[model samples]
Target chain A: MPESTFLDSTELVLNMGPQHPSTHGVLRVILKLDGEKVLGTDCVIGYLHRGVEKIAENRTYAQFNPYVDRMDYVAAISNGLGYCLAIEKLLNVEAPPRAQAVRVILTELNRIASHLVWLGTHALDIGAITPVFYCFREREEALKIFENYCGARLTTHAFRIGGLQYETYDGFEKEVLAFCDMFLPKVDEYEELLTNNRIWAGRLKHVGVLNAEECKEYGVTGPVLRAAGVKWDLRKAQPYSGYQQYDFEIPTCENGDTYDRYTVRIEEMRQSARIMRQAVEKLAAGPIMAKVPKVIKPPVGEVYVSIEAPKGELGYYVVSDGTTQPYRVRVRPPSFVNLQALGRMVAGGLVADVVAIIGTLDIVLGEVDR
Target chain B: MADEQKPAGSPSPAPSGAGGVNPKAGPAAGAPKTAPPKPAAAAPPKPPAIMAATPWDSELARDLRDRFPDQIGETSTYLGQDFLIAKPDAIISILEYLKLEADFDYLVDITAVDWPKKPERFELVYILYSFAHNRRVRVKTSIADGYRPASAVGVHLTANWLEREVYDMFGIEFAGHPDLRRILLPEEWQGFPLRKEYSIVQQDERWVRENLGIESGQ
Candidate 1:
């Protein structure tokens, strides 16, 4: 004990839920707060960790496809496509042209759907509720198209080892065309609701500013990097699965803020739609599967293949020792890498702005935890 | 012996002893006198070695090898691409050189592969990219049981999670990683599941029996 008098001090710590609605999915963030100003924040994840990579090692190449879909359930098709492309490269097998075109179509549609969820939830997180309904209205249509192709809506798992497991549905073109016609106007409606609104602009502009240099140094890609004025799109820079044959633009923003990220994703929705339309137009008559042997025992080597996933560069690093099962399968999940910048972005901002920034990043906790 | 008797640049050999002349000669060459044979119509040059372009193709790897000649080991060209298998101790040094002198700027990924049969149990693969040069380089170093490669966390912040992941799966320690805790797996997890010697059946049975209520030995 001190000889003289001593004053007592204490700090308050709050456990934001592993169950809270806004935590997204079983994510417990330990926030050291001083009246809505975060002194420090530590994210405690793994409640949802299922040891996906370990599971992948035990499973064969084909059996692992459905499991990856569960990693980023919001954009399952992209996850499936990334894994398929990596396995294909390892096998040294090329997907037929028609299959590549269909893969592109479905992945872009999934991108639109994934962005819709982001837009809807981000808008909802910031007190605007109507756009969620609007987003769902369009998302339902996209899910219908997915269901038509793979008999499943959310986790289509449409892709396979060498190519697609099956061809596109008979009327897939008409459904996608109809969706595109309606999706563009719906994107305009979302822009009308939030893009120029003073309240929305005030909340997001210049908030959580991550510059272009920082974005690249941190390996932040997809809309987040494009939002920071770096025009490094995997689809354009390193195209996969016939993405090069399609026509689209990679949108970028000069200001690297939450607003910039929002604008970039919105524009990306339109671009994804454009790519989908082009894919549908280019759909030709051909075989879907390459002449792959039944037992897919790729040579003993490792290959890393990445695709322009909805969130960012979703890469799959597969090592095969001429075995049915991979020696090691590492998924370079974009959400997990992108979420690393969370602490930096939300460091000194207000707690409300922290939620906005998180929403702006549009992370799906499934992928993060996996 | 008949094949060996043909001249160096002759299009077709004459049937022996036909005045040592090629039978298929064109009109311009038919009346040719012995004017030193006009240098035999200068033969086309042979193709260059495919491996020659490998070093030039990846400026980042080439520059690093040049800058740190002693530290960087022999560069191997595989499929017309260069890969440097450096000594384990020189990994961090090369990474620092790559970031500071070469401006690699991005550490794309840090992964490890288990080659159990080899003397080196693990191959730690670090793929670095230079946006300025628009080229990528795969830097690898062998990790044995008692030895661990130096971590590149100081050079690239992106390696923090990746190194942890490699440690998590492969159990190849990154010597100076700040937080080398298990990333994708829980702390109490028993073994490095990715190792070939690790028994997957035991883990599978344990998981299935404990988590999913499925009985073992099924």
Candidate 2:
């Protein structure tokens, strides 16, 4: 017997954005919703894809350094570090001690800057505007330090194949020290504003809870996985670029909720500061460049190198065929993988909580779409 | 020193005393020598073999070899790393066995390489990581022109998008990929741009025409 179907009970399909403001960046999230609760969410990326890997196959090894910065513009230096480390591993070259120390300082500063942008915009998305301004004030100082070193701020192509393109400029250390002196106090100010504020707590606490098992199943890392109580930071588990020498803590939270994610990142900014301070103190004198062959031709082989990028484990897999150009280059972008867990996290939550969950994930769409 | 003698941009040949025939330089010329006579006195207790049988356990390699002898072309255990090379058709079966029997749950990455000089135009590489065992294995399969390899998307859901990306760039088809649409490029784009022969000039024209259709000529 055929039963009569009712069309009135059907779920509404909403297009959240190939253009909407809060989808992060040209990301189109196809949402199937029933009333105010989300039934399902399908994330459609690639809108901002520039074919970076394809472009890398044609460009010389030296020429690809700058392009890596565009993959995650918010954390430009970290992306550059990942690509450079992969290339360096293939070539079997090690950067000088001073260069490694400087790289640690710069990348940690970049991590702080990236987290500030995420906190500010993420808070703004949830209707907290004052924190955005405060976040930018601190971020400006970090950008100035970057500009002093590389003559560029936002998309700094500071790294090179073998080592740094140039040594730290005169007065660079003084400027970075000044920023750090002021920056730690600014982190406390941010904590006072949002960390314990009742409204902020109400909005975030227990809103998007994803436990450690679920995090691993979905492959979410960085703050998301740490908040879920997994102590699997690539920096600690598998150190690359001399991360083993640094003394910093990997902060974790047991709740695995939106508030936990926020707290973890806040604590991470402090640890990044601690790491930067150690890097500056231990800074040494040596040649920045490694003694690499001029026309670099690594024997045919493939190497996968990953770093603890601000978002998560940003890995680069490079295939060399004894030539200047790489045979293949694949980037295991953290945002793209981390964003896969969004649907599971947001399925049963209210529409308002979706913004909070997205904030907690802290995804940069350029990294995702790349 | 070898570093001083080598000129810029030239590939340095391996030293003659090094083991194996240097790939760049042909085998060294020398007459064969007879084995030396054994000493009359009892030889000092043979030093324990300096080299372990292979860094990786040979029994595991033998087990894998026995399981897929027909499909596996080679099993290499060097420096505590294992590499298994197989035909394109048998990748899914081998991967499934690894995932089910062994606990290699994570598909770390999937990539492809182009070798213009080889009989096979492309080599599809899959790296799997096992968190349980704290070990990693690399599987490679060579594909000739216009042929497709069986997809591993059935084993790990994450491989669906990754395989699509590999197909999009390398123009190598995955026979059983659920959704094989163009990911980075527009659906109507003419050719796979990452292949060695794909022209950058063609991309320039396409970029201009797509962005500014009528004004491209001007």
Candidate 3:
């Protein structure tokens, strides 16, 4: 204590949320700070743990399809698609062409909806509240399509195991295409509001930079990895659910800053819209469901199927021991793995930049703690 | 039985027997509607067993086996996916070999499966994706309970939290984890929920009662 001097660096520990509002959800980050600069961050998660993987073991394959939607509620359709694809692979029967087209349209629409929520809230966290209103208003249109197709908004278990639960509604293609037409112009409106703003650029430009090498090493994925110049998307990489037929580009940025992530996600919304329009055009009338047995007793084996969720790679590794219920269903949730890079991303940044970086990561705590 | 098994394919059986009665009957008793797929006793074996995943040796698997003949066990392909079962002791070498030599740069996920009945009760699964090759491979190794497997954080930084997750959910400890207390559950919480014996509704009731002043919360 006597040797303490002004030149000697001392760190102060700050406890930021198990309930702090700025944090996305119940994420408690123990921040070691040297004045304004952050020394390191320890993310204390699991406040919303529901033991979802354990729940899968107790439920049958068809019974557990809806449970996946709760993990990433914002992108619930994407989760449903991943689970359905995994089960279908386990059963060794592909969904009919019509079902595959509808799945593509719904999942791509969910991608846009998810990115809108992220853009709105992320901008709101950084003091740009105007885009939030515009974002949600446009999001309502997409949610309307979801409601019309599946009678639910957020956690819509839209797809069943082998195929869709219901056939496409009378105007499913028309409605989804209408949403696409109405959605693209609104994306431009939100971009006009924040993309060139002075404070938006200043707060995000050089803040919390993680490069390409570090991104892969830390296993950070989705837009965060793409923003770091890694040209990787699970849709393009693995091509599940007929994504190969859809033509789109993976947007990447040289700088992996918060601003770059914002740009990457914004461009991603455009590409998703492109996919939805194409999927609508590609929608041909055919049988929806495959010849799945009354009891779905898959062989004793395993299959890993991943889809490009709105967040990142949402993978389902389903192990079947020749039973109706899966032996093990381990979800490699993107947000959970993406959240691990928080300490690395927030290290050595300003304490104030912590929220911006967390917002930039775009983590959903339900998926993180599931 | 053959007609019932191939409801759409075998139209010859419907013409041979009761063809006149089937025509006179109403829509409920149609000729093609012989019976549901269940009651026809001589149904063939499920096609999935014939298509079940088997031990496969691809060019890459053969190359890997040549390098680590003693360590590699079964290299199986299931539904177009290839996974290798490796020995627990040589996991790091195999992972490093794949990373450096085979260009499996991205460690996609790390999860563990609990097989309580087996002598090696824990099967650790590592899913690795290679960007250069545009392929993914699963590497699994089984170990006895309470065995402190070497931590993979040194080889792949992504394994830090993923391994901690497996440890938190299954109570398997890694030997060299930097901070492996608990990621999802609290420090005071007990029981690994993902283990097979742990029921779905099970929770750490003592911790809940002490912290929240409630008897139990699940």
The most accurate candidate by TM-score is 3
Candidate order by decreasing lDDT: 3, 2, 1
2 or 3, which is superior by DockQ?
3
- What lDDT score goes with residue B73 in model 1? 68
Give candidate 2's root-mean-square deviation (CA, Å). Answer: 10.8
What ranges in model 2 sit over 4 Å off? Answer: A1-8, B1-63, B76-82, B100-102, B116-119, B132-134, B145-148, B203-218
What class would a CAPRI assessor give candidate 1's docking?
A: incorrect
DockQ each: 0.09, 0.09, 0.26
Best by DockQ: 3
Model 1 residue A6 CA deviation (Å) reads 21
Candidate 1 per-residue lDDT, tens place, A48-94, comes to 77768878877656667788999999999999989988877765678
Each candidate's clash count: 0, 0, 0
Q: Would you list the rank order by DockQ, best first? A: 3, 1, 2
Model 1 spans with C-alpha error above 4 angstroms: A1-10, B1-59, B77-82, B188-190, B201-218
**TM match of model 1 to true structure:** 0.84
How many residue pairs clash in model 3? 0
lDDT tens readout by residue for model 1, B1-218? 23333221222433433341222222112212222222223322432322232333356656766777887666765433347878888888888887777777777788887878789888888877676766566788887865777888787877888888788777888888888888766666667777878765545556556666878734
Model 3 TM-score is: 0.91
**Superposed model 3: Cα runs more than 4 Å off:** A1-9, B1-51
Better of 2 and 3 by lDDT: 3
Ten contiguous residues minimizing lDDT sum, candidate 2 chain A: A1-10
TM-score of each model, paired residue for residue: 0.84, 0.83, 0.91
